[model samples]
Structure formats: structure tokens, C-alpha cells
Target: MHRFYLPPDECLKDPPRLSERESHHALNVLRVRPRDRVVVLNGAGDELLCEVLNAERRALTLRIVQKNAIPPLPYQVTLVQAVARGKAMELIVQKATELGAHRIVPILSERTVAQVDAEAVPDKVEKWVASTVEALKQCGSAWLPRVEAPLTAQAFLARGDRFDLTFIASLQNEARHPREHFESFRSERERSPESVCVWVGPEGDFTPAEINAVRAAGALPITLGPLVLRSETAAIYSLSVINYELQSKRGQNGHLK
Candidate 1:
């Protein structure tokens, strides 16, 4: 079934209507006709199975046929990613959404290649939001990850937000495999973490001082094997491992495959 996105508030209308952008895709692009079955997502865990009532250019009307409320993931996963060059950031956002990341924070590290001026942060964030929406529709995900304004690594660290388990991909000798940390957490706590965050540095990786600062802020150094992955690859790999260990139910009983 074709999918469309509507915010929670708009999804509640007596006869829900797609936004202008979505409307164009439904009416002109997809040529959805009356009585066609489609799915609408509120991006807040609500999925409305609806039938098209009208497909006007300006307004596409849909009547709810069924509504499914998917519970959010047991644990929240936050991706603190350094902005990569070119379109890599967008690709990361899309894959992160597909992997069920709860939130994404784009950071500007000292070695980041894609430099964004202060005034351009909003525009960059907007593009990232669009990427998430497209990903949601394509992947049939019920929840959309919140995209945060890009911030410097230092300023972001200053926020002092903590998670149940935190990781930073690093090449330092002290870094250990992600599985080791999961095993240690399971051994000590006897349960999977309720929330997790993984930090992925830019092309050249975080400066030693920045790495030390993150470590001081309670982030464990995680090694992504012997090979160094790009920023986007590291982000996807981190989220995948986290989803496997935490959301995949394998760790519920203190064992993860």
C-alpha cells in the first residue's frame, strides 16, 4: 500500500488531509484514485489504514479504515553523528530511521569536512527532516526519529545529557568491541540498557582532547573492528548492533546473538 505522512495533530481531522507536499505526490505523482487503499503515518507510532475519498491537487482526502498503534521500541537509541561530506549525512539519517533510531544529533567535530555557517544550520536540519520522512514512508516505520540542529562536538557535550549506555567509536588502544560493553553491562546490571547513544566521529575522527572529553562524560570507547569505517558506515553499524542487542529481544534474557 502507498504511504503518506501527516503530523499527529493533522491526522486527527474529521477527514484527514495530506499536506501540500504529500498531496502532490498522492494526486499528481501517484495518481491515487478514489477508493484506493493507502496507509498514513503520524510519525508518533500511529498508522492509519485509510481509503482515498478524493484526490484533488490541493487536498487529498482519506477515510480511516483501520488504525494501528505500534508501541515504541523498548529502549531509545540516539545517534550522535558527525556531519559527513557530500550527501552522506542524508544517507545516515535515512538508514538510522530504518534501523529505528529514536533520535539523531548531528555534530560538527574539529575534523568535520562539511562546514556549515551558523545561519545555515536550520536549512541543513530541514533537509535532514525531509530525508527522515522519505525514509519513514519507504521503510514503513511507524515512528520518525527527531533530527536535531547541528552543533559543535564541544557544545553538544556541554548539554550533559546522559544515557543508560553510551559509546564512542574510536581507534584508541583502550577501545573494545561493542559486544564486550554489552556483555559487561549485562553482567553488571542483568538486563539490557533502557536507553543508548553512540557517537561517530568525522572523517579524521575526533581530536584526542574531544575523545577524552567524551570519555569523561561517561561514554565508553567502542572499537568497530580492525578497519576504520566512514562516518555514515559507523553510524549504521552502531545502530544495527544496538538494535540487535537491545531491541531485538535477544538481550532480554541476558543473551544476544
Candidate 2:
């Protein structure tokens, strides 16, 4: 069945209406007709099995047949990605969402080349979120990842205490391997962390000062492997690894509580 995203407000008791853009896609592009069964996601863990009631150029109305709650991942993973030039950031958002990242925080590292103005942060976040929404629809995921406004390395570190596990990908030899670092945390905690956030630097990586700041804020330095990876690659790779590790653990435990 085809799936679409609708805001929560549009999902009340009354028949829900789709936005003009979605309406056009359903009416003109997909040629959906009345009584067609489809799924609509609210991006807040709710998925509605909806049937088309009306289709017009400016609006598409759906009647909810059933609603199901799609639980989020067992372990929440947030990617602190540095703002890379051009399409790299967009790719990061798309793949990271598919990899089950809970949130994406774009960072401004000392070595970052892309300059995002303060006024543009909202627009940038919206664009990344739109990319995430597209990925969710393609993958049939009900929960949508959030894309946060960009922050500087220092500012990001200042809020580091909120995460149960924090990792900063570094090329420095002194850093521990990511698997080993993650395993160490698993052994120590009674239960796996509910939230983990990994920081990926820009094309040139984080500056010495920025690294020190993050380290002092309790973020551990971890290495991906011997080969160097671009900012977007590192973000997706790290998220993939984290998702695999957590999902494997869940399988071993039989189910999540």
C-alpha cells in the first residue's frame, strides 16, 4: 500500500485533509481515486490505515480505518554531523534516517568550509527534515527522525551531558576503536543507553581546540577504521554500526521492554 505523511493536527476525528503538495502528488501524479487504501504517518509513531474519501486538485481527504503505534528504535542514536559543502549534508540526513538515527544535529566545526547563516538555519533544518520524511516513506518507517538547527562544536559540547553515550570520531591514533569503546560501555551499564550521539567532523575534521573541548565535556574519541572517511560517509557508517549493535542486542534479549 502507498504511504504518506500527515501532520498530527490533520489527523483528528474528522476526515483528514492532505496539503496542496501532497494532494497534487496523489491526484495528478499517482492518480489515486476515491476508496483507494493507503497508509498515512503522523511522524510521531502513529500510522493510520486510511481510505481515500475524496480527491481534488487542492486537497485529498482520507478516512482513518485503523491506527497503530510504531515504536521507535530500542536505542536512540543522534548524529552530530558537521556541515559539509553542498550535497554531502543532504546525503547524511537521508542515509542517517534510513539507518535509524533518532535525530540529526548539524555542527559547525572549526575546520568546516560551509558557512550557514543564522537566518538560514531554520530553512536548512527543514530541508534536511524533508529529506528524512522522504526516506521514511520509501522505507515504510512510521517514526520520523528530527533534524535540529546547526550548532557550533563548543555549543554542542556544552549540551553533551544529555546523552547517555557520546562519541567523537577522530583520526588521531590515540582514539580507541568504536566497537571497543561501545563494548566497554555495554559492560558497565546495567541497561544499554536509551540515547547515543556520535559527532562527525567536516572534510578537514575538528580542530585540536574543538577536540579538546568535546573530550573535556565527556565525549570519548573513537576511530572508525584505518581509512579516512568523508564527513557524510562517517556519519552514515557510524549510525549503521550503532544500529546493528543495538538491534543485535535486542535480538539476543528476545524483545525490548
Candidate 3:
């Protein structure tokens, strides 16, 4: 069955209408027909089993058959990726979403090569979000990750400590892999953190000052492995590790730690 996102509010009634854009995709691009079974996601962990009712003139209507509430992940992971040039940035967004990042933030670091003017933030975020949406539909993710506006390193440093757990990818050999942090956290782990944020800097990576600031803000420095990884690779690989442990820590009891 094809999956699509329609916010819960918009799906108020049984025969709800898909939004203009999604309607066009369903009616024309996908050519969905009446009686076709489809899955509609509310992007808030709810999945509605629906049967197509009508598709006409670039409009779509669906009748809800069943609603399923997906259980939330054992832990939330946020990916803060430094802005990179061209396809690199999009790849970060796409792969991160597929790996189940709860939120995606494009950070503008001192060494960031991709610059987005203040006025362009909205459009850039929209593009980033569009990439995530594709991933969400393809990966069957019920919860949509929020794509935040570009944040400067300064802004990130100031509030980065807000997460229960935070990590900053570094090239320093002394830096530990994310598994180490998760293992340690799980060893005597009293409780799983509600949220975790992983930072991956761009190009030349973050400046010494930026690293120091993030470290001071309680963001632990960690490396993916022995080899230095591209910013996008670091984001996806690190998050994949975190996500795996998050899943494992949630035992059959439905509790982490």
C-alpha cells in the first residue's frame, strides 16, 4: 500500500481530503484509484488505514478504515549537521530521516562552506523538509522529524546542552565511538534519556573554539571510528548506532534501562 502524510487535524472526518499537493500526486502522478488501499500518516505517530474514495481533477478523497497508533521510540535522536555544499547537505537530511532522527538542524559553523542568507532559511528548510518527507514515506516512519531553520554555531552552543544527552563528532583519536557512550549510559543507566542530539560538522569540521564551546556545553566529543568520515557519513553512521542501542535497551518490558 502507498503511504502518504496528512496531518491529524486535516484528517478530522472519515472521508478526508488530501491537501492540494498530495492530492495532485495521488491523482495524477501516482494515479491512485478508488478502492485502492492506502496508508495515511498523521505525522504524529498515527497511521490510518484508508480506502481511496475518489480521485478527480487533481483531488483525492479517502475513507478511513482503521487507525493505528505507533508506539514512540525508546529514545529520541536529533541530528545537528553543519551546512555542506550542494548534494552533501541533502544527503544528510535524507539519510538522517531514514535513520529515524527526531529532528534535523542545519548548523552554520565557522568553516561551513554553504551559506544561506537569513531570508533564504525558510526555503532551505522547506527543501530539507521535503527531502525528509520522501524518506518518511519510503521508510514507513510514522513520526515526522522536524526540520529546524539553520542555526549558527553560536546559537547552537548556547542551547545545545538542553538535550538529556549530546555528542559532537570529532577527528581526535581520543574521541570514543558512540557505542561506548551508549554502553556506558546503559551500564548503570538509571533511565533512558528522553532526547539525544548528535553533532556533525562540515568540510574542515568545527573550529577549535566551536568544539571547546560545545564541549563546555556538555556535548561529549565522539568519533565514528578510526577513519575520519564525511560530515554526512558521520551523521548517518553515528545515529544508526544510537538508534540500534535505543531499540535494544527497550527490553520486552517496554522500558529502556
Candidate 4:
């Protein structure tokens, strides 16, 4: 079924209207017609199995056939990614959403090659947001990841938000293996944490001072093997591994996988 995300408040109306962008995608790109089965989702854990009533409007009129409230994932994942050059950031945002990142916060670090001027951040963030929407549709994900405005590494670290677990992927040998973090989590809680935040640095990796700042902010250092993956790759890879570790339920005892 085709899936599209609508804001939660709008999805509650009797006959919900698809947003202009969604309408264009359905009518122009997909050429959908009346009676076509589609699903309208609001990223806040609600979805409607609906049929198109009219595709001619700026907003498509949808006849909701079923309503469902999907419980949020047991573990909420936050990705703190340093902005990358070109379209790399969009790739990070798209895959992060597909892999189930509940939020994406772009950080500007000393090594970050991406431009972060005041006038540019909003436009860039908007494009990233659109990418998330498209990714949600393509991946059939009911949850949309919140993309925050780009902030400097210092400012982001200053927030000092606590999570059940926080980790920063690093290339240094001193960094513990990701397995260790997973094992520690299960050992401590008998299950995955209710929330996790993973930080992936920019192109050249975080400067020594930046690393210290993040560590001081309470993020544990973890490694993704020996290979030096690019910043965008690191972001997606970290999320994939975390999702696998937390999502896998093969062992009823929650033993180390």
C-alpha cells in the first residue's frame, strides 16, 4: 500500500485532506485515482487505511476506512550527526529515518566541512525535512524523525540531555567496541534502554577538544570496527547496529546477541 504522512492534528478530521505536496505526489507522480488503497500516517503513532475519494483537489480528499494507533517503539533512538558536505546529510537523514531514528540533530564541529551560516541552515534543514518525508513514504515508516536546526558542537553538547545510554562513534583504539555497550545495556536493564543517543562526527572526525566536550557531556565512546567509514556512513551504520541489537528478540532472556 502507498503510505503518506500527514500531521497528527490534520489526520483527525472526518475526511482528512492530503497536504499539497502529498496530493501532487499521489496525483502527478503516482497518478492515483479514486478508490485506490492508501495509508495516511501521522508520525505521532497514528495511521489511517484510506481510499482516495478525489485526486483533483490541491489536497486529496481521503475516505478513511480504518484508524490505528501504533505504539511507539520500545526504545527511542536519537542521532546526533555532524553536518556533511553536499547531499551526504540528506542521505544520513533519509536512512536514519528508515532505520528508526526518533530525532536527528545536526551539529557543527571544528572538522565539519558543511557550511552552517545563519541564512543557509533553515533552507538546508527544510530540504532535509522533505527528504525525511519522502523516506517515510518509501520505507512505510509511520514515525517521522524530527530534524533540528544545525547547532555548533559546543552549543549542542551544552544541552546536556540525558539518555538511558549515550555513545559517540570514534576511530581511536581507546574507544570500546559497540558490542560492549549492548552487553552493558542488557546486563544493567535486562533489556534495551528506553532511549539511546548516538553521535557520529563530521568528515575528519571530532577534534580532541570536541571529543572531550562530548565525553564531558556524558557520551560514551564506542567504535564501529577498524574501518574508517565516512561521516554519513557512520551515522547510518551506527543506527542500523543499534536497531538490530535492540530489535532482535531471538533470545527470550535478552542475552548478548
Candidate 5:
């Protein structure tokens, strides 16, 4: 079924309508007409099975026929990623959303090459948010990851936000494979961490000083293997490993709890 995005605040409208951009895609691109059934996501776990009531050039009125609320994953994952150069950041945001990351914080590390001036942070964040929305619709995910404004790594660390399990992709000699950490945690705690976050460095990786600071903040160094991956590849790889190792055994339907 085709899916569209409607903000949470607007999802409960008497007759929910798609925004101009989505309306354009529905009416002009997809040629949706009245009575066509589609799914509309509020990005807050609600999936409305809607029937098109009216389709105009700049508006798509929908009559919701059924609404299903999907429970969020039992665990939350946050990706603290160093802003990659070019369009790589967008790809990271999209994949993070697909991988069930609850939040995405783009950081400017000492070695980061794609530096966003303070004035442009809002625009960059806006674009990343759009990418998440697109990914959500494409993947039919009910939850949308929050894309935060770009901030310096130091400033972000100073916030002192805590996660049950925190990892930093690193090349340090002491770095351990992610499976080891997952096994260690399971052995000690008898279950997966409820909240986890991973820090991925930029093109050249984090500086020595930055790595030391993150380590001091309690982030365990995780090795992605022998080969060095690009920043974009690292982000995807780190999230994939986390998804595989940290999730509890799946239910009979092959869905993670």
C-alpha cells in the first residue's frame, strides 16, 4: 500500500489532509484519486488506513477508515554520528530511521570535514529531517527518528546524556567487537540494554583527544573489523551490528520484541 506522512498534530483533523509537498506527490506523481485506499503515518506509531476523499492540486483530503498503533521497539537506539561530507549525512539519517534508531545527533568532530556554520545548522537539520520522513514513508515505519541540530562533539558530550550501553567506533588497540559487549552485558544483566547509543566518527575519524574524551564519558570502543570503512559505511555498519547483536531473540513471527 502507498504511504504518506502527516505530522502528529495534524493527523487527528476531521479530515486529515496531506501537506503541499505530499499532496503534489499523491495527485501529480502517483495520480491518486478519491476513494483510493492508502496508509498515512503520523510518525508517532499511528498508522491510519485512509481513503482519499478529495484530491486537488495542492491538497489531499483523507478519510481515515482504520487506525492502528504500533508499539515502539522495546529498546531505543541513538546514533551520535559525525557529520559526513557531501550527501552522506542524509543517507545516514535515512538508514538510521530504517534501522529503528530513535534519535540521531549529528556532531562536528575535530576531524570532521563537513563543517556547518552555526547559521546553516537549522537548514541542515531540516534537510536531514526530510530525509528521515522520506525513509519512514518508504519503509513503512511508524516511528520517525529525531534529527538534531549539528553541534560540536565536546558540547554534545558536555550535556551528559546517559545511555544504558554506549559505543564509539574506534581503531584503538583495546577496542572490542560489538558481539563481545553484547555478550558481556547479557551475561551480567541477563538482558539487552534498554537504551543504547553509538558514536561514529567522520571521514578521518575522531582525533586522539576526542577519543579520550568520549572514553572518559563511558563510551566503550567497538571495532568494526580489520578494514577501515568510510564514515558513511561506518555509520551503517555500526547500526547493523547493534541491530543484530543487541536485539533479544525474535518472536515466532520473526519480529523483535
Candidate 6:
């Protein structure tokens, strides 16, 4: 089944009209016709199974056949990624979405090569938002992850209080292994934190002062392995580990049921 995302307001008690973008995709791209079944996500974890009632050049009306509330992930994982050069950030967002990241926040550190000015942040964020939408459609995800505006390292560290488990992937030998750090947090997993954010530095890594500041903000320094990965690779790898650990626990306890 083809999946598309629509606004919560577009979901009426009965059937509702599809948006212009969806309408175009359905009629022109997918070539969907009347009576064809389609799925629409409200971007808030609500999934609507609908059948096309009318297909026009500019609009496609759909009749809701079934509605399912897909609960959010038990443990929300946010990626605080340092800005990378070129399309690396785009690749990170796409793979991270498929791996179930709840949010992506771009951080600007002293070592960051690409800079998004105040005026360009909106445009950059818009691209990331679009990438998330396409990723959800490709990966069959029912919920959309948020893409936040770029922030400086100082500003990003200032928001540390929001997460119950915060970690930064570091290359320093002093950094503890990710598994050990994860185990420490897992001991308190029963409390089920509302969110967890992991920070990944740029190609050159965080400056000593920046790393110290993050540590002061309560983020534990964790190592991926002995080898160094690129900024985007490290972000995805960290998120993958988080999702695997949490999902494994859920499966073991039958919480997935």
C-alpha cells in the first residue's frame, strides 16, 4: 500500500479531502484511481486506511475505512548532530528516520565546516523536513520525526536538562565504551525516560572546551569503538545502538504486544 502524510486537520470524522501535494502524487505520480486503497499518516502516529472515492486532476477524495493509533516509541531518541559537509547530513537524516530516531538537531561546533546562517537555517530545515517525509514513505514509518534548526554548541548544551540520558560520541580514550554507558542508563530504564539525546561531533571532533562544557551539562562521553567514524556515520551508528537496545528490552519483556 502507498503511504502518504497529511495534516491532522485533514482527517475528518468522515472522509476528508487530500492535500494538493498528495493529490498530485496520487493522480500523476502513483496514478492511483478511484476505489484504490491508500494509507495516510497524520504525522502524529495516527494512521488512516482509506479508499479513493474520487480522483481529479488537482484533488483526490478519500473515504476512511480504518483508523489506527500507532503509539510512539517507548524510548524517544534524539540525534544532536554536528553539521557535516555536502549531502552527508541528508544521508544521516534518511537513515536515522528509518532506524526510528524521534528528532534530529543540528549543532554547530568549533570544528564544524558547514555553517547555516540565521537566514539559511529555515531553508536548511525545510530540506531536512522534506527528507524526513520521503524517508517515512520509503521506510513505511507511521510517524514523522522533527528536524530542528541548527544551533551552536553552547546553545545545544544548554538544553541538556530535557533529556534523561544524554551522551556524546567521543574519540578520546578516556571515553567509556557505549555498551557500558548504555548499561548504566539501562539500570534506570524502568523509569522510562520521555526522551534521550545523543550528540555527535563534526569531522574534527569537539574542541576540548566544548567537550568539557557538554560533560558539565551531564552528557556522558561514550566511544563507538577504537576506530573513528565520520560525523554522519557516528550519528546513525549511535542511534542504531539505542534503538536496538530499547527494542530488545521491549521484546524480552513482551512490551511490544
Query: What lDDT does the true structure give each of the candidates?
Result: 0.90, 0.83, 0.83, 0.86, 0.90, 0.82
* Best model number under lDDT: 5
Local distance difference test, candidate 4: 0.86
222: Cα error in model 4, Å? 1.3
- The residue pairs that clash in candidate 5, if any, are none
Instruction: State TM-scores per candidate.
Output: 0.95, 0.93, 0.93, 0.93, 0.96, 0.90
Stretches off by above 4 angstroms in model 6 are 13-15, 188-194, 251-257
Per-residue accuracy of model 2 over 1-257 as CA lDDT, tens digit each: 88888977788848799889888888888888999998898888899999999987898988989999988766788888889989888888999878888888888887889989999888888888888988888888888888889889878666644887889998888888766765676778745567888888998888889888888878888888899998888888888777776665554342332
TM-score of 2: 0.93
Superposed Cα deviation of residue 44, candidate 6 (Å): 0.1
Judging by TM-score against the true structure, name the best candidate. 5
Model 4 misplacement above 4 A: 249-257
Ranking by lDDT: 5, 1, 4, 3, 2, 6
Q: For candidate 6, list the clashing residue pairs, or say none.
A: none
RMSD of each: 1.9, 2.1, 1.9, 2.2, 2.3, 2.5
Model 3: weakest 10-residue lDDT segment is 248-257
Error of 6 at 46 (Å): 0.6
TM-score of 1: 0.95
Candidate 3: give the clashing pairs: none
Question: Worst 10-residue stretch by lDDT in candidate 5?
Answer: 248-257
For candidate 3, the per-residue lDDT at 128 reads: 86
Model 4 RMSD, rounded to 1 decimal: 2.2
Which residue ranges in model 5 land beyond 4 Å of their true spot?
248-257
Cα deviation at 120, candidate 3, in Å, is 0.6
